[model samples]
Each structure stands twice: as structure tokens, then as C-alpha cells.
Target: MIVVDGHCDVLWRLWEDPERSFSDGTLQAGAERLAAGNVRAQVFALFVPPQVPRGQRLKAALAMVDRWHGEVVENAGFRPLLWRDDVPRVTGGDRPWALLALEGAEALEGELVHLRVLYHLGLRMVGLTWNEANEAADGCGEARGGGLTRFGRSLVEEINRLSLLLDVAHLSERGFWEAAEHYDGPLVASHANCRAVHDHPRNLTDDQLRAIAESGGVVGLTFVPAFLTGGEATRDDVRRHLEHAESVAGEDHVAFGSDFDGIDRVVAGLEHAACYAEWADYLLRYYPASSVEKWLAGNWLRVLAARLPARPMTNL
Candidate 1:
């Protein structure tokens, strides 16, 4: 299967410590597992925390992407994938493809011009907010639940103009609807779950799920325990979310978004990427193979190929 995860924090973690590659023993999963597990492409996000200095957020993000690129170039088994165009090449043989993404709009520093710079730097996928509000949009945790700001509107428009995919994973409810109602193309909740199942503000409400589906977007079911079951989330916990997401967003709009290396806690049986195959086995009982393919990776890829521009080599 050509698996494409919409989210992962390996890039930020690697930048924190380049000594530990995916092939290294420290992290849960790495480049080696991606190749071995038949993951065609994995989106490695440049997660910028709100606490980080505003001026330094973009720098930090770039540094993380650079670290991943260095690892891929130095390692024969790994391949760096900046655009959809490189997918064929990266997955042609046994190598695994790496796609760079931004976990928050903080990297843009509240300026649409900064977005252009980041896009030029090779960011194809962008999450409008993290757990806090910024110049771009409001996060789920924001007290006001504000929608896209003036600057955010410009950013979203520019993203659409440039054919860059917009993700509303951690956005506030207002911002989520704003993006859904305003954006003309496909949208994504790159790493989120159903609010009906978890009641957490971080999860998507039923209205948001339908909006995503109506907009022709997908919602990546997260692997965090709280989102899956709020207790000891096992393989069954993830299964419940998967089933619910399929029921709400339809089978084509559900996919795996293992916030690996970002969330401190993972579901009991889904601690790493290698366990995805096992997760697949568990899912097989409830869903058909075709439905499973879309959930595993196909849905996200289809959206990207349909809406976003191929990654330009100059940026990365």
C-alpha cells in the first residue's frame, strides 16, 4: 500500500537532535520503518510552538526541514520528496518518500508575504492554527473561538491562489467553518478526531466533519489516546474513531494521522508506524480493502493531487 500520513513530528524532533535519525534507536519510528512498512510517503511537519520567538519560528521550521533533507541525502535508503512530482521517483524502488509540512501558521509570522517565502521554501501543506491563535487564525483552545482574521483571510486566499493545501486540524470552531465556507478547493483536518466521540475541543464536531466532506476534504483520524477514547485507547479505540469518521465523513474522507513524536501518549497497540499494519488487520474486519486504502493514505493524496501544485524543486 502507498501510505501517506498527513502528519508527523519527526522533523521537529530531529532538528532538536540530529544525532537521532529514524534509523536510530531513540524515536518510535524512523526512515527504516517507513521503507519496511511500505509507506510510500509520510508528511513530516515543522511544528512551531507558540512559545518560540516569533522571528525564530520560520527559522526553526526551516532548520527542521533541512535536517530531514540532510538525513535523506546521507542515507541511501531514504529519499526526500518536495513535490507530488517526486512521488513516482521516491516510491519507484524500495526507498520511502518524505513530504515537508507546516504544523502551524506561526511559521508565516502573520504576514501573507511571509507565506510566499515559506511556500518558496517548499511548504505544500499548512495547518492554519495549532492550539493557540495567531495572525492567521484562532486555535481550538482559544477562548473566543474566533474565525480567520483579516491577515488570515489574505493568507488563505494566497494559499488557494498558489494551490497550496490548507489544513484546519487545530483551528477554532469559527476558523474551521471560515476555512470550509471560504476556501474554494479541498480542505483537510490533517490531524483530528470526532468531537462526538471525545468531547474534547481538539476533536471535530459533527458539523465540521460534514463541512469537510462537503468541501471535498478529508479528516485524518488522530492516534492520541484522548481523541480516540479518553481512557486507555487500544487498537479498538482507534477502530471506533475510524468507524465513526467513516460514518460521518464517509470512507473516502478518513485516513490515519499519527501525530507521532508530537503526542506523548499513543494508543496501546499503536505506539509506532510499524504497528499500522496491525491496525490495518483490525480495520479489515469492519471495512473493505478499498475503504481501508482510502483511510490509510489514498484520500489525502487524491486531495493534494487534485488541489495543490506539485512541489517545486527550488524551494527544498
Candidate 2:
């Protein structure tokens, strides 16, 4: 079975001070684990933390993107994929598909010019905020769930114009509603669980889930234990959120967004990317192969196909 994970913090680890690598050593979901699990593609998010200075955040993110790009360039087997045409080509051979993404719009630094710069750098997706308020949008973890700011609205316009995807995962309630109303394309909660099951701010509310579904978007059921069925979550706990998402958002909008290397509490059996097939096996008893395929990979590809243009990657 081919798996397409919607989000992972693998890039942060790959370029951090310690300098993580995927060349057959040192981590769980490296090239080795991915190949062993029959994984087709994995979206590695450059999730910028709030601890960094405002001016330096984008630089840090770009540094990570540059490092990954270098790895892809030096190794022909792995390539950076940004469009639908690249997807089929990257997944066709022994190569593992890599989709570059930004986990927060803070990297934009309240400037639209930065958006174009990041786009040119091969960023295909952007999450409006993390857990703190930024110039773009308010975050769920902020004290107040204020809506998108004026700059945030402008940011969305440029994002739509550039044909880049907008992720509302960490945005506040008001920000989410605003994004839904403003953006013309499908939305995504790259790594979030169902709030109906768990009351964490990181989880999505019922109305939020409905809005995404109505907009023809996908909700990647995150694997963080805290957001699962509460304390000490297991594989079954993660399944609970998936089942609820299928019922509310329908099977069409549910997908996997394991927040690997970013979260502390991961379900027991579903600890890493390689365990994707194991989770699929357990889900098969509850869902058909066709349904599982849509949840695991097809739904995500559909969202990308709908949002991104057929622009070619020119800059190396």
C-alpha cells in the first residue's frame, strides 16, 4: 500500500544543529524506513518555532529548505516535488517523494514579497500561524481567538494568486472562519485531531471540520497523543479520531498527518512513519481497501491537484 503523510517535522530535524540525515542512518523515517514501508510520498514541514526572532525566522526556514534541496540534488534517487506532474514522476521509481511546506506564516514577516520569495524557493503550502499570534493570523493557543489581521487578509490574496495552498491547522477559531471565507481553494489542518473527541485547542471544532469539508478540503488526523482520546493514547486512540472524522467530515476529507519528531506523545504502535502500513491493516477491518486508499493518500493528492497550478520548478 502506498502512503502519503500530509505533514512531518522531519526537515527541522534534518537541518538542526545536530544535523540529522536520511542517508540510511540516524532516524526513524529516513530514506530506509520510507522505502521499507512502501511509502509513496511524505510532506516534510519546515515548522518554524515562535522562540526565534521575527526577522530571522524565514532565514531559518530557508536554511532548512536549502539543505533538503542540496540532499535532493546530490542524490538522483530523491527529488523535490512541487506539482502534480512531479508527483507521478517522483513516486514512479525507487525515489521517495518530498513535498516542501511551511508550518507557519510567521516566516512571511508581514510582507507579501516574502511569500513570492518562499514560493520561488519551492514552498507549496503555508500554515497561517503556530501557537502564537503573528502578523498574519491569530493562533489557537493565543489568549484571544481574534480573526485574521489586515495583513493576514492581504497574505491570503497573494497566496491564492501564487497558487499555493493555505493551511489553517494552528489558526484561532476566528482566523479559521476568516480563512474559509476568503481563500478560493481547499484548506487543510496539516496536523490536527478532532476537538469533539479531545478538548485541546490544537484540535478542530465540529463547525471547523464541516467548513473544511464543505470547502472540499481534507483534515489530516494527527498522531499526537495529547490530541487523541486524552491521556496516554494508543493506536486505538488514534483510530477513534479517524472514525469520528469519517463520520463528520466523511471519508473523503480524512487523511494522515503524523506530527513525527514534533510531538512528544505518539501512540504506542503507531510511533513512526514505517508503522503506517500497520495502522492501515488495523483500519482495513473497519474500512475497505478503496476507502483506506482515499484516506491514506488519494484525498491529499486531490487537494494539491485542486490548489496548485502546473508551474514548473525552474530554480535549482
Candidate 3:
């Protein structure tokens, strides 16, 4: 089966530690491990740490983008997904495809021109905030729980105009609703769980899940143990979250996000990408082949096909 993971922080890891090899098994979603997991395509998030000086955030993002170009894109085992047509080329191939995504709007530094530049640089997805207030919007961790800022509204419009996938995984409740209300395109919570299963703030509530379903978007059921439960998470905990997500979002809207290198703890039996085949087997025991396929990659494929631009655009 071809798996499409919506989120991984391997690029941030590579940027933080230049000596690390993507093929090395030390990291959760290393290229070798992704191949073993049957992951045909993976979204690599360019996450700028909050501590980075404000003026240097864009530089950090560009550096990670360059790292992606040098390491994953130029490598024979992986291809950078520059357009929607690139999606099918990964299936049955010896290697996986990589898609670039921005985890936080800080990279834009409150500038829409930078957003356009990043889009042209092959960034196909954008998340407005990480876990705090930014020039664009309020994140899940914000105490005031505000909605999208004036600039954030414009950014959302620009994202729709550019046909980039809008992610709501870390948006505050108000911000999420604001996005749902304005953006008239396919949406995704790249790496998140169902709040109905676990009360973590990072998890989406049933209403939020249904909203995504209604928009013909997908919610990537994440592997973070803390998001799954207050205790150690097992395959069963993962299963519960998926089951509840499917119930609320519908089968077509639920897919695996597996926060991979971005997370500190993983589900007990699913510690790395290589374990996906085993995880799929466990899922098969409960769901039919069709449902399992949707959860694995089909749903994400549908979103990509529907939302990504038909051809690469020129800012000129």
C-alpha cells in the first residue's frame, strides 16, 4: 500500500544538525525508514523555532529550504513534489516524494510578498501559526484565543489564490473557525488527533473535524503519544483516535499525519516510519481494505489532486 504522511519535521532536524544523514535510521522519518514504511509521499515541514531572532526567521526558513533542495530534492531516492502531477510518480517507485510546507507564518515576517516567493520556491502548504500569536493569527497555545488578524485574512486569501494547502493543526479555536469561514478550498490539519478521544488542546474537536469533512478536506491522525492520551500511547490508543476521527470526519477525511521527527514521543508500537507496515496490519484487523486505503493515502491523494495548482505558476 502507498502511504502519504501529511507532516514530518525531518527538514528542521536536518537544519538543526547539518551532519545528520536523512538515510540514517536514527531519525524517525529518515528516507530509508520511509521507504521501508511504504510511504510514497511525505510532507516536510519547515519549522522556525520561536527563539530565533525575528529578523532571522526568514533566513532560517530559506536555509531549511536549501537543505531540502540539496539533500532530498537532489537525491535520487526522493523527488521534490513541485506540482500536482508529481504525486502519481511516487507510487510503485523505489523512492518517496517530498512536499514542502511551512509550519509557522513567522517565516513570512508579516509580508505577503515573501509568501508568494515561498510558493514559487515550491512550498505547497502553509500553516498560519505554530502555537502562539503571530502577525497572522493566534495559535492553539495562545491564551486570548483570538481569530485571524487583518494580515492573516489577507494571507488566507493569498493562499487560496495561490492554491496552496491551508493547514489548521495549530490554530486557536477562533482562528480555526475564522479559516473555515473564509477559505473556500480544501483544508487539512496536517498532524493532529481528535479531541473527542483525547482532551488535549492540540486535538480537534468533533465540530472542527466535521467542518473539515464538509469542506472535502482531510485530518491527519497524528502519532504524538501525549495528544493521544495522558499516559503512554499504544496501537490501541492510536486506533481509538482514528476510529473517533472517522466517525466525526467520515472515512474519507481521516489520514495519517505521523508528526515523526517533530514529536518527542510516539505510539508504543509505532516508534518510526519503518513500523507503518505493521501498523497497517493492525488497522486491517478492524477496517475493510477500502477504508484502510483511504486512511493510508487515498484521502490525502484526493485533496492534493483537487487543491494543488494544475501547473506551476509564475509570479511575474
Best-fitting candidate, measured by TM-score? 3
Q: Write out the backbone clash pairs for model 1.
A: 22-30
Cα error of candidate 1 at position 179, Å: 1.5
Candidates in descending lDDT order: 3, 2, 1
CA lDDT scores, all candidates in order: 0.78, 0.82, 0.90
Model 2 vs. true fold: TM: 0.94
lDDT of 3 at 49: 95
Candidate 2 local lDDT, 79-106, one digit each (tens): 6667656655643676677778888788
Q: List the candidates' TM-scores in order.
A: 0.92, 0.94, 0.97
Candidate 1 structure quality by residue, lDDT tens digits, 62-153:
78767766775456345655556664454367666666678878887877777777776667788888889898888989998899999888
Model 1, residue 90: C-alpha shift (Å): 6.9
- Among residues 3 or more apart in sequence or in different chains, the pairs in candidate 3 whose N, CA or C atoms overlap within 3 Å are none
Model 1 RMSD to the real structure? 2.4
Error of 2 at 286 (Å): 1.8
Q: Which candidate should be chosen as best, given lDDT against the real structure?
A: 3
By TM-score, the candidates rank as: 3, 2, 1
Model 1 weakest lDDT span, ten residues long: 82-91
Model 3: lDDT of residue 156: 95
